[model samples]
Target: MMGPAAMLLLLLLLFPVASAAGSRTLVFILAGQSNMGGRGGATNGTWDGVVPPQCAPSPRILRLSPALRWEEAREPLHAGIDLHNVLGVGPGMPFAHAVLHSHVLPPDTVVGLVPCAQGATPIANWSRGTELYERMLTRTRAALAECGGQGKLAALLWYQGEADTIRREDAELYTGRMETFVRDVRRDLAMPDLLVIQVGLATGQGKFIKLVREAQKGVKLPNVKYVDAKGLPIANDYTHLTTPAQVQLGKMLAKSYLATL
Candidate 1:
């Protein structure tokens, strides 16, 4: 019988093309809703597939596929993970790229990005018992395990709240739900001090945008930080971040990530 790791590897459709010696990987989880899942060229019902220069692939970065395999990291990092959305570009790639360029870690360290953000998902959907929450944890654990015990989960990047803004009740409960979500994830992962960098809302689903943004900013979790997306340019629908804005957000995420170190 295959060992657990072996069984997991067998399910992966892509294997990492790592460095010759395979450096230790520092993993980051990109979660939340549409913004974190990216929507760069998405318009109408299709994606234009235009990747920006800043979000380009790098030799030192790899992303965990929806199938749990590690593949060369590329644009639209959440394409396979965020099932319902037409993905174009998200912040994961550019964030990883900026982190690498900043040389925050050792020069040889590899970055593993695990994209688990399902677009249009409400914070309520991420409660402990839900399939979405379970899947996120399962995939994240698998990611840390894949690198032969050499991978470390560095942080989680969250960027949801717009969905909750649609309903007054949801908006009212946003901060408490987010606080619970953060606590739950940190506890379950056995990383109570795990760093979390969350983006404050720039756009929203309804009248509660302000309330939801306040909720995002109000979470007082330790080691948790905030990056505001309020002024970033939006896409055609004035909802999702544009390609350039995604690049900027990636840089912002990198700034926050680097600051933690």
Candidate 2:
């Protein structure tokens, strides 16, 4: 009952939407300090044959390789062995798997991760004015572009604050600065509705940890979600997470993200 011209126009209008619906692509930004960079070792098993239940061939998961390039050790030249040894499983993999299992995405959905993390770097280091943060931002932008542009970015997962806790004044300014950083990242990426997952630091004990948690909770951003790492076990180093604990944390992060979707 439709004219040829009308039908053509309708098809034109719906083409992009239909295509997007058919193949959903999610780009996840993983940025923070050491934890976000993944301190654990790579799995001895092969990942090529592994596929999450929800992932399709077209929209596959992409993770930044050559790990630890972004880890900012005190000397900046320290070997990554220690960091790699403790590395078990981090949040990125589980998050992707959970999204697929949740069935919240379309068929042929691909999830990508762009990790930019540095150890021993304070929140201020990621500030807009700082060179370190600027470099990180540049790298993140490049990674996103390489992955397929803004359409790919579904969320930004952050796990930091340990370094900031070392200083009382920095701790006081953490929340506001974090808010600003999130805003800046959104603006830079030109994605206003991008979800942000802020994982609170897992320091064994202290009022400082509590303050950081309160600050994250008080931020009041609708798209910003918080993950608690309070009771999680830590590595023998007393700061980082053990391999098993990291795996659990990864699962927890995936669950949190899935809940939002």
Candidate 3:
């Protein structure tokens, strides 16, 4: 049996479409913990909420379905990932909207979102060689395969670290682990200079929150940028970003990505 990384490489080789996907299909991966998976609403653990107009589904925006195929993009981008329960508004939608409307890419380009976020998960869950990491890699490969030789990964939108804020050690070592994770992802995907937009932890478990946020903002690496989540509105639970905030954050992510391009 081949490892997940090996399997993905094989898939890329076997499916010429993966590499053939040039710049016609702009691909992005929405990753991280609960916030990224989207738990925001008037109620907790429920998808019941108002869908912001900015996040309205567009035929041009496609998402990686659970079946490992591309389909019309929708809210709660992480629905395909099994670990998340509630599927509410996530930042991916607004981010896509911003990119589509912005002058970053050609007008004819289509956006492909690969959702692999798991709610409430810690950084350790996404550590290299972990199940979550392997699953994410496999799904990413499947998304590339779905491109049909016309798409390519543009950037990665990461919003996480709340869970890791609970532990002092996790908060302390976050910078190193996160740097490693970014390096590993880029290297494995054969994109040495892939753009990685890491969102800073807005709020979390009391004392350690600052540590994680500091680590996030202080990360120094090529092709890696940090987006501030400070002052972002929160849900009723005060954990996840509210729908409006998600939209704002998504736009912020898009702006950050566009600056790089």
By the TM-score metric, which is better: model 1 or model 2?
1
For model 3, residues 124-234, the per-residue Cα lDDT tens digits are 889889988988889888888777677788898898899888889999999998999999999889999999999988888546999999888778999899899889998
| Candidate 3 Cα misplacement greater than 4 A, ranges | 1-23, 82-84
- Runs of candidate 2 with Cα error greater than 4 angstroms are 1-23, 41-59, 66-88, 148-151, 204-207
**Segments of candidate 1 deviating more than 4 angstroms:** 1-22
Tell me each candidate's RMSD, in Å, in order.
Answer: 5.3, 9.3, 8.2
Weakest 10 consecutive residues, lDDT, candidate 1?
A: 13-22
Which candidate should be chosen as best, given lDDT against the real structure? Answer: 1
lDDT assessment of candidate 2:
0.61
The C-alpha TM-scores of every prediction are: 0.92, 0.71, 0.88
TM-score for model 3?
A: 0.88
Better of 1 and 3 by lDDT: 1
Return the clash pairs for model 2, or none: 27-152, 39-87, 40-87, 40-88, 41-87, 59-110, 72-119
